[model samples]
Target: MTSGTSPQANAAAIVGAARRAASEGAAMLFTPEMCGLLDRDRGRATANIVAEADNPVLAAARDVARELGLWIDLGSLAILRDDGKWANRGFVIDAGGEIAARYDKIHMFDVDLATGETWRESAAYTPGDHVVTVETPLGRLGLAICYDVRFPALFEELGRLRCDAMRIPAAFTVPTGKAHWHLMQRTRAVEASAWVISAAQGGRHEDGRETYGHSTVIDPWGDVVLDMGEGSGLGFAMIDPARTAEVRAQLPSLANKREIPRSAS
Candidate 1:
């Protein structure tokens, strides 16, 4: 979704997407990172970045989730934490409108791009410590955000937990997205022996930032099941739990994994 600076507008978009997804027989809907509001200007964003309890986008999503009896994975929201700091938080709302799980994005996207784009994510958002996962219609779903996809250790831990599927929603820059998005996604799915579903922000947003929007889904076997390239719309793919079993039986990498010893000084 090309989420804008207005939280109300973004909320409406999420609600409409959920209704449409439910009408089409989808048990769950996944959204991109910063689905509630994406603004480069921190000062302007501060007004909309309220506590999770007061976030309109989250409130609307819960209402719609209950109304349609569908689960909605809000990719991530800019939330004002109780500690008075901010957090990049993601939510998994169950079909009953209850918050099943919440994940604070651990890996911050602090980088300088070749295109002269600089980001200091850790400057505004505090990093999360714990790894989070939950059970849903998609099986045991491991939760992660944009930059978290680049860290293999996180996915390795999720694999250790035997997650059946993982969601890594993102709002990636065009340059980096072109370079590592699909490669890293397929690798994570293959390594974990789990399905990877990533809904992404596409097109230019209201804040004048363009996202690399190839919202993708890859099966456990590293096959591309769905790729919504540079588009903003809902796409679907069928997931077979047996496929995960098949891949694990064939590779068994997770089973064979061992801790690597530190290099001798």
Candidate 2:
């Protein structure tokens, strides 16, 4: 979604997507990072960034989820933490409109790009310190956010937990998306022997920032099942749990994994 600075507008987009998804026979819907209110301006964003209970976008999504009887993986929202900091928090609302799980993004995107774009994510958001997963219609779903994809340790933990599918929603920079998006996603799926479903933010947004919008899905075998290239819309793909089992049986990487010895100085 090309989520803008307005919480109301973003909520509408999410509700519409949920309706469309349910109508299309989808049992679940996944969105991108900052699915609600993607305001880069910290000062301006402060007004809209409220606690989770008070967030209108989340409320609307919950209401719609209950009405439609659909599960929604709301990619991530910028939430005002109680400590006066912020959190890039993702929510998993079950078909009953109840929050089944919440995962705050652990890896902060602090980088200076050659494209002249610099991000100090840790400056605004406090990182979370837990690996979270939940059971859904699609099976055990592991959760992670945008920049978290860069760290393999997180995915290793998800693999160790034997997640059936993983969600790595993002609003990626154009340069990095072009460079490592598909490669990293496929690698993660192959390494874990799990399905990877990544919804993404696409197109130019209201805050004058452009996002690389290739919302994609990769099977356990690292094959691209869906790629909604450079657009702001919903897409769908079928997942087979049997395929994950098949791949694991063939490679057995997870079974063969042994604790690495400490590196010598």
Candidate 3:
């Protein structure tokens, strides 16, 4: 879902999407980054959105998780904190309406693209210090945001944690996404030997940002099981634990890694 820079409206849209996913028999629902607000006006956007725990949208998401008896993964949000810094956080709401786990995005996108696009997330948000993996009904799940997808070490850690699946929620720029989105996503899945469920913000937003849509779910074999092309709607696919196990057993690359030197002297 493409979120405008409105907190209330975006929260409502998330709740609505959760209800729809539940109605469709999805055991879990996932949304994209900036699920709350994406405003170019930094001050207004920060003021309108929740940058901390126990905010309205988090509460509403927990309630939806309870009502639907399904897991809800709300993509990264700008969490306002008293420390005067924002955290790029993701939530994993268990079926019982409890926040089972949370993960802050570790990698910050501090790039100056040649296409006249630039972003310095570190200016407004503090980077998370650790990699997090959460246990779920399906399997251990790794959490990551947009720019984090480019780092293979993060996925390596998740693989070490025995994660069977990973969620990469992104609001990718049109240029980058069109060039490397599918290739990178499929590569991560194959490397980790885990199913990848990527929910993305498609289309242009009020912030004048165009996200490359085509939210996809890839099987452990690195095959696209479902792809919601450049549009706004629900995409669905079944994630079987058996498939993950089968793929790992067939090709155990994770167990065959060689330790590398930490640095050059």
Candidate 4:
């Protein structure tokens, strides 16, 4: 979604997307990261973004999930923290509108780009320390945010845990997204031998931030199932467990993996 600045506007967008998903018989609907507000305006973000307890956008999304009878993966919401930091958090909402699983993003995107694109997420957000995987109707879904996609070990461990799919919610900058987004997604899917669902924020946001908008889903075979091109929209893909099984059987990379002990050398 084009999250812009208003939480209400974002919530309204989710409702509309949910309706469309329901009509098209999509059992699940996923939103992008920081679904509430994507403001680089520090003061505006501080004033608008509230704690999860006080976030109406989240509450409204829950209501929409229940109302539409759709399992909703709320990609992530950047909420205010007591330490005056941001909590980039994710949630899997059941069809009943109840939160089934919650995950805080572990990897922080603190970078200094030569293109004058600097982001100091750790300055404004407290990073999560643990990996999170949860059971879902589709399969065991591992949760991660944008920057977390770069960590191969995370996907390796999730494969060890037998996670069937990985959910990534991101708001990627255009330059980096064009360069690395699809590559990372395809690579991760092949590495983990798991389905990958990457919901992304596309186009320009209200805070003058331009995000790479191709939200994509990859099967265990590393085939792109759905790619919502550079735009503000949503799409559906059929996820099959048997396909994952078939790919694993043909490749068997996960089963063949042997970790070497460093100190033994």
Candidate 5:
């Protein structure tokens, strides 16, 4: 369950999805990254979005979570802060509609592709310094966003922290997603021995930018439990915490890890 449009619309869609999933006996609902505004023109996109702290959209989501009695993983929002800048922030809203925790995206997408896909997120947004993991009935959950999936060390750190699951909400470009999406995701799951729930933004937007939408949920054994493909729809999977324990017990890779020094330029 994710969105790639206006904040209000995204918020409404999330509430609807949450209600529907709850009716079907779902305990939690997760969303996609940048679940608010999407503008091809970066300048204009920043202008149209809201601040995370007092956003009407987030408020609505909180209300819905409270009313539905389900946990809501509000995907990353473009939050305009008082410092005249924005942050890519994710929120975990409890069943009671209270904010359980917040995780800001630490890895900024700063790439220059041969396909003319150039992005320097750090130019416009600040990076988060802290790693965030939250406790839930399911297990300890680590939080991440789009480009963060490229870094395996993050997942390993979460594994070291004893996290059972990780969430990656993305709006990946078609070219990149096709080349490395599944491989990267599965690799992370295998290395960390944790389940991954990745909700993605799919289809071309009104702004003319295309997203590679293959919302996937992978198990600890590196198997894709569900894949939503390149379309607009909901994908669901039941995650068993025992699977993580089983996998880790079978192959304890974490205990054999060693730190090595690197040369500095």
Candidate 6:
């Protein structure tokens, strides 16, 4: 859905997306990273962000989920932590408005691009140590956020958990999005032998930042089933549960894995 700097505007976008999903008979509403707010200005971001206890976005999501009976993957929000940093967190809400799981982004997107772009996500967000997985009518969902996608071992660990789907919600940079976004999703889906649902932030933001927006959905066969281009919109695709088993049987990489101990020097 559309993500600007305004929380109200972003909430409006969420409503629009939910309406679209409801009209289309979609079972879930997956949103982008910082779907509530994406601001570069520290003062404005800090002012707009709130603790989860007082977050209107989360409350609205619960109400919408209850009303529409739609599961929501509220990507990541810049939540104010007690340490003066915001937690890059993702939440999965069930159709009944109950939270199924929450995951703080483990891998921070701290980097300096060759094109002069730079970010220090770790400076403002604490990393998570636990891998979160939860079950719903959909399947076992292994939750993760933006920068975590760069680490293949995370997906492999999820594979070990027998997760039927993996969620990698992101606000990726333009360069990285163009270079590795699609390939990353495909590779993960194939390697994990599971569905990968990625909802991404697209276009220029209210804060003058551009994100590589191509919200992608993939199948176990390593095929991109849906790729919503660089725009502010929603796309839906059905996940065939049986396909996961079929793919695993076909490849059986997860089964073939053997742990190698450290060599004694």
Candidates 1 and 4: which is better by lDDT? 1
Q: Number of backbone collisions per candidate, in order?
A: 0, 0, 3, 0, 0, 0
Q: What is the lDDT of candidate 3?
A: 0.86
Clash-forming residue pairs, model 2: none
Which stretches of candidate 3 lie above 4 Å from their native place?
51-54, 261-265
Q: Could you tell me the lDDT of residue 90 within candidate 2? A: 98
Instruction: Select the stronger candidate by lDDT from 2 and 3.
Output: 2
Report each candidate's C-alpha RMSD, comma-separated, in the order given.
0.8, 0.7, 1.5, 1.3, 1.9, 1.2
lDDT of 3 by residue, 12-101 (tens): 988998998899888998989878777767877767655456477788888889988989998878887668778888989999999888
Superposed by TM-score, candidate 4 places the C-alpha of residue 33 at a distance from the truth, in angstroms, of 1.0
TM-score of 3: 0.95
Tell me the tens digit of each residue's lDDT in model 6 across 73-178.
9998888877767788899989998888989999988899999999998777789889999996669999989889889888879999989999999999999888
Error of 3 at 88 (Å): 0.8
Query: TM-score for each prediction?
Result: 0.98, 0.99, 0.95, 0.96, 0.94, 0.96
Poorest stretch of ten by lDDT in candidate 4: 78-87
What C-alpha lDDT values do all the predictions have? 0.95, 0.95, 0.86, 0.90, 0.83, 0.87
Better model by lDDT, 4 or 6?
Answer: 4
lDDT of 3 at 89: 88
The candidate, 3 or 5, that scores higher on TM-score is 3
lDDT of 1 by residue, 27-134 (tens): 999999999999999999999999989999999999999999999999999999999999999999999999999999999989998899999999999999999999
What lDDT does candidate 4 reach at residue 136?
Answer: 83
Model 4 global lDDT (CA atoms, 0 to 1): 0.90
